[model samples]
Target: MFADGAMVLGAAVLCGSASVVLGVLGVRLIDRRISGGGRAGMSASLDAPIQPMVFLFRDGTLVDATAPARALLDRIGPPDDDWGRLMRWIGPRIPVAREQMQQLARLGRLDLRGGEGQGAATLRLLAEDMGEGVARITLCDPQAEHAGIVVDSMSLQAMEEELGLLRTALDQTPMLIWRQDAQDRITWANAAYLRRAENRHHGALGWPLPRLLESPRPVPGAGTATRRAALEEHGQVSWYDVHSHRTGDQTMMFALPADAAVRAERSMRDFLQTLTKTFADLPIGLAIFDQRRNLQLFNPALIDLTRLPAGFLTARPTLFDFLDQLRELRMVPEPKDYRSWRQHMANLESAAATGHHVETWSLPSGQTYRVTGRPHPDGAVAFLFENITKEMTLTRKFRADLLLGTTVLDGLEDALLVFDSHGQIILHNEAYRAIWGEGEETLCATISAWEARIGAGPALAALRDALGRAFEDRPLSGAMAGPGDRLLGWTLTPLSGDRAMLRFRAVAGQPVPGRAELFEAVGDY
Candidate 1:
C-alpha cells in the first residue's frame, strides 16, 4: 500500500511525462481497433511527422526530454531551473500567458502556449500510474487543432529582404548614423563613422560619445544641433549636424558632415578680417550700411570724423539713427526745418542708393566735411567723409592771389598775354583786348598763338618769331608796324614751367620802359 500511494503521488506530480506515453498508446489502440483484431495490420497515416518536444521530471530533477526539446533548450542557454527552463526562453510578447503557464506547470496540469517552432503547436502534460513507487511523466508538443490555418511564408521572406536592403543603404550613405543607450554609451555606428574613426582599436562601441570627441558630451535633445568633432585617431576635425530621436531606452543619432560649410565660414571670416585691416588704415572715413539700412561696418576715420562715441557706433544702429546721432552732435548738416527731417533722411538714402549724393557740412566748430555717398553690392550703401577744411583754405588764398595779380596787370599800360607750353593763349589782360580790339568772342574762347598773330597782321610776324625764340630759352625784343602807322614794341620773356609772357607797347615815339624802369614804376604804384 505504501508503494502504491507513492506511485499515485508521483504520477500526479509528473503528468507532463504521462501525456506523451498516452498519446502513442492511444494511436496504437486506434490502429488495432481499425484492423478489427485480424492480424493487427497497422498502416501509417500519410501526414507530416509531428516533431515531438517534451521534458519529463522525477521528483525535482530532469529525467527525460525529447531530442528537439533538448536541442532548443540548450540553444537558448544553460538550464538553471527545474521547470524545464522553457518559460524563460519563450518570447516576452505574452508575458502574462508565460507566467500563467509556468504556474500551471508547477501544479502538474497540462498548459501551453498554442504556438511553437515558427508554427502553431500545443503543449500537453500528463501523468500515468505505474507499479511501485514510480510514475511516468510526459511533456508533449501536439499539432494544434488550429494549425490547419496556413500563413504565407513569402511575407516573412520579403520582410527580411527589405531589412537587409535598408541596412545596405545605411552603410553606403555618406552621413553617419549612431545608436546610443540611455546612459549615452554608443551602441552601434554606421560605416561612415567607422571610416572617420579609421581604426577598430578605438572601440567606439560601448564607449561614451565624448571619448571620441573633444568634449565629454554634446548638448542632447530632440532638436538638431551642430558641433565640431575631432577624431582622436587621425586628429582630423569636422563639423556635424546631429539630430536625435528617442524610442524607449535607446536613442538614434543622425550626423551629417558639414566640413565644407565650416571651411567656407572660416574663409569668409579671414576675408572680413583682411578687409577690416585694409579699411582701418585708409584716410577716408567709411561707413557701410546693409540692405536694411543698419550700420554694419565703420572705419576708424569714421569715428574721428563723426566725433560720435565708439560705444554708440558699436550698437549697430540703423541709418536714420546714425544720422540722428550725427545731427545731434552737429557733425552732419543741420536741417532747415524740424518737420523736414524725415524727408531729408529719405532723400539722403535715395541719393545714396543712386550714388549721386554729395554735400558739404560746414560745422559750427569751423570744421568742414565733404560727405559723399556711393552704392555698393547687395543693396548696400557706403558714405565717405573727408575733412577738406585746410584744402579749402589754401584754395581760397590762391584765388585771392590770382585776383590781385590780375588787378596789377590791368593797371599796366602795356598789353600782356600769357601762353602755355601748348601755345594756347591762356591768359590775356584787359589792356591786350583794348589794344588788339579783341572782343569777348575772342577773349572768352581759346585762341592759338598762330591765330592771334595772323589776326594782328604781317607786322606782328616778328612778335611771333620772338615768342618762339623765348620758348627756346632765348628772350627776344623787337619793333613791328601796327595797324595805322603806329609802331608796336614787343618783348617775349620765358617763365618757369614751360610758360612765356609776351608784352606789347604801342609806342608814340620811343619804346616802353625797360625792366628796371617798369619795376620802379610798379613799386611807385
Candidate 2:
C-alpha cells in the first residue's frame, strides 16, 4: 500500500512488490505503447506512449504535472486550472485581453512562453467531453524547452527497466528483506520473508513485525543490529546476520541465513558432551590442553589427583597456569631449583610434543604418581596421572618375600629342591645344587629330576621316582644310598597348586642297602 490511502490491486501485486506509487502509471503507459496505442482516438502510427505534460480535471482543476512541467510551471505560481488563475499564472504570455481570458480553456493551441527570453512552449490540448458539461484535458508540448527543460524518453525507459529488475531481485533473493514503519508495523515484506513467517499467526502485512519472532526486541540506538531470530513453531533456532537501517519514518531490515555456523556450534557442543561422558568414568586422571596451551578439558579424576580447586579448573586456565596451580598443590614434583620452574615447564612441553614425557612424582604426602604426557591431533597435549603407590608397595613386598625365602633355604642344613607341575626344577638352594654337582648356571635353566640324577648311581633312580610321583600330585618319602657308604633320606612333599618340594638329609649311619636298612637309618636320624 502506498501512503495517503493508496491501494494496490490484489495480493499478487502486494506480496513481493516494492514501492509502486510512481511506477503504476509508468507501467500503464508502457503497456499502451506495446499494445499499439490502446487509446480510442489515438493514432496507430505513433512511436511512443502519449505522456501528457499536464493533467486537467473536468472542473478545470489542475490534477498533476510531469516533473518538467512542474519545474517550469513553478516559476509563476501554484498551477491551477481556474481560468482566472491560469490567466494570472501565464500573465503576459497569453497575449489575450483580460476580459476574454475565460475562453482560454476552449482554445485548441496555446503558445506559452515562460519568463524571460526563452522560446515559446507549444502546448497541444486534447480535450475529452464527459456527459453533462464535464471534460478531461491532457496538455502535450512538442517544442517545450522552458529554461532547458527536456524529457528523454530513452532515459525514462532505462530507469523503468532498472526499477523492474530491482523489484524482481528483491522478490527472488534468498535473503529475507522487509520494511517496517516507526510504529513497528510490517509495511512491506519480500517473498523470502513471507515464506519464513508463513506459519505464524500474525505474519501477514499490516501486522506488527515483531510478532514473527519469539523474542522480538529492537536494537537500541540508530545504528544497525545483528541478531538471531528463534522461530517458535518448531523449537528450531535460526541464526541470522541482520542489517537494519532507517529510511525516513521506516526501518528496513535484511537478514542472511547463518545456519551452518549455528549447526557447527551445536555439533561441537554435542561432541563435548560425549567426550565428557567418556572421560568421566576413566580411572586415570585426564587433562587436555588446546593449541593455545589452555586447559580445555579435564575429568573428575584430575581434580582428585591434582587436588587443585574445582573453581580454578572451571576457569579454563592456561597450561602453565594449571601447572603452577598443581605445583602449589604439591601434586607434581617440587622443582629441583624453584627459580627455573618455568624453564622446566617449557622443557616438559617440548618433550610432550614428541610423546616422550614421563615422570614419577613423589609427593610430600607419601603418595606416588606416574604422570605421562602424550601428543594429540591439532596441536593438543593430553596428560595422564596414575596413582602407583599401592602397586609399588605390592611389588616391593613380593620381592622381599622372594629374598627372605631364598635366604632361609640357603641357610638350611638339608638340601632342598622344588619342581613345578611340569616336572622342571624351579627352586634349588646351594646345598641342593652342590649335592647334585650343579652350578649357578643351572638356576632358571630347565633341569629334569632325571638330569639331576646323572652321577648319583642306582639309589638315585628311587629318588627320581619319588620326585615324579610328586609332580603327579602324590607325596612320597624314602632313603637312598650315596657314595662312600653314605645314606641320604629324601622326602617329596606336594604343595598347593600343582607344585612340590623335595628335601634330602645325609644319613650319619653306615650305608643303607634295602628298604629295611633305609627305614632303620631314617628312624635313627
Candidate 3:
C-alpha cells in the first residue's frame, strides 16, 4: 500500500510541473504580441514627416518650436521677457493670438490659431497633459494660411491707389473743391481756390471758415442763429458775404457747398472763388457795411450811380459822413425831412445791438431804391441795393404822353411808330394808325411777334436789319413805295441798347426834303 501511494504522488508532481511550464510559455507569447503591436505603431508614427510645431506649456513656458516657429520667435525676441518688451518686438510684426489652457494636466487640450510674424507665416501651439503633473506642448507652422492674408493686403493697397488717383482728378477740376470737418474747419482746398481773391494762400487746412474771417469787420449772415442751426441740422447750401482785409476793394458772397464737411482742405479756395465770382457778377448791386454802418465795398453799378470816390469807403467810415456828403451836394434836397434817412439811422442803431435791419429809400430824382441789410458770418452787415428809377420814370412818362396824344390823328400829319430792333411795332401815334388802317393796340406784342407777322420778307427783313444797324450808332434811311407808286419816307433811330424808333411819312404829295442827312447827323449825336 505504501509503495502504490508513493507512485501516485510522483506522477501528480510531474503533471503539475508540466502544466506550470505551459502556462508560463503562453503568457510569454501574449506579452510578445503586445510588444510587437506597440513597436509597429511607433515605427509608423516615426516614419511620418516630422512636421515643425510649437509647444507652449501651462506655466507660460514655450518649447519644442519647429524650425519656422523658431525663426519667428527669434525675430520676435525672447518669449520669457516682459509682455511690454515682447510686444515691442512682436506686436507690430505678428498676429499674436493669446489663450489660456484650462487645468492643463487633466484637460490635455490645446487651442490653436494663426499668428502674424515675419515672412507672413502662421504658427499654432498645442498642449497635452502626461498624467504625472507634467504637460507636453507642440507648435505648428502654417505658411499657406498666412499667404492669403498677404495677397488680400496687396489688393487693398492697389485699391487705395486707384481711389487716390480718382480724388486727384476731382481736385484738379475747375469747380471749387473743398472739404470741411464737423466743426467747419477747412480740411482741403483745390488749386483753383488758391487763385481766388481771399484764398490766395494754398494753406487753408485746419482753419475754421468763420474764424478765418477774424477781422474786426463783421461777415454777412454770420450773426444769425438760424443760419448756424441750418448748418448744424440740414447741412444745406448756405450763402453768406465775406470780406477779407487781404482782398482789397471787394466783398464776396460765398455759396458753401452742401454737406462739404468731410472734404479736403485743397478745395476750399476754389469753392470760395467760384462763389465770389457768381455773386459779384449778379445784376443786382451788393455792398458790405461794418457795425458802424461804414461801407466796405460797392459794385461798379453802385459806384457809378453814387458817384462816390473809391478808396475812401472802408469798414470804419462813419454813417454821418455819408449822409452829410449827400446833403452837402444837394443830392438829397430835404435831407432833414427825409423820413427814410432817419429810419435808416435808427435801423442801423438797432442792428448794432440786435445785428440786422432792412429798409427802402427814394432819391430826390424821383427814383426808388430797395435796400436789404443783414449781418454777415464775420459779424458784419451786407447790403443789397436795387434801383427802380428807370421803371418808375417810364411808367410816369407813358401816362403823360398817352394823355396828350389822345386826338389829332391825320391832322397833325406827323407819322410816328415805335418799333424794336426786330421791326416789331411797340407803339404808334394816331396818324400812323390812321395811315396803316390798324388800331394802335394791334401793334405786335414782341419783336419776334412782328417778325413773324411781317412774313420775314425782304422789305420787312431789310427794315429790321436797318433798325438793328441804327441802334449800333449806324444811320439808316430808305424810301418805301406803295401799290400805286406812292412814295413813303422812312427813318431809323436807336432808342436803347436793342430798341429802335421808326417813322414813316407820305412823300408823294408833300415837299419832302432829303432827311438822310438829318438822320446821319442824329446818328453821330
The prediction achieving the highest TM-score against the true structure is 1
Preferred candidate (lDDT higher): 1 or 3: 1
> For model 3, how does the per-residue alpha-carbon lDDT over 78-111 read when each residue is reduced to its tens digit?
3444222222332222323222444555556655
TM-score per model over all chains:
0.62, 0.57, 0.26
Residue 157 miss distance in model 2 (angstroms) = 8.7
Q: Which candidate is the best by lDDT?
A: 1
Q: List ranges where model 2 is wrong by over 4 Å.
A: 1-170, 177-190, 197-203, 207-229, 234-237, 241-254, 258-264, 274-283, 339-344, 356-358, 434-456, 479-487, 509-525
Q: How many backbone clashes does candidate 2 have?
A: 0
RMSD of 3: 21.8
- The predicted structure with the larger lDDT, 2 or 3, is 2
Residue 449 displacement in candidate 2 (angstroms) = 10
Local distance difference test scores for all models: 0.66, 0.65, 0.52
TM-score of 3: 0.26
lDDT of 1 by residue, 251-338 (tens): 6677767778879989998987888899999888999899999988888989888888999988989999998888898886667886
Estimate the lDDT of model 2. Answer: 0.65
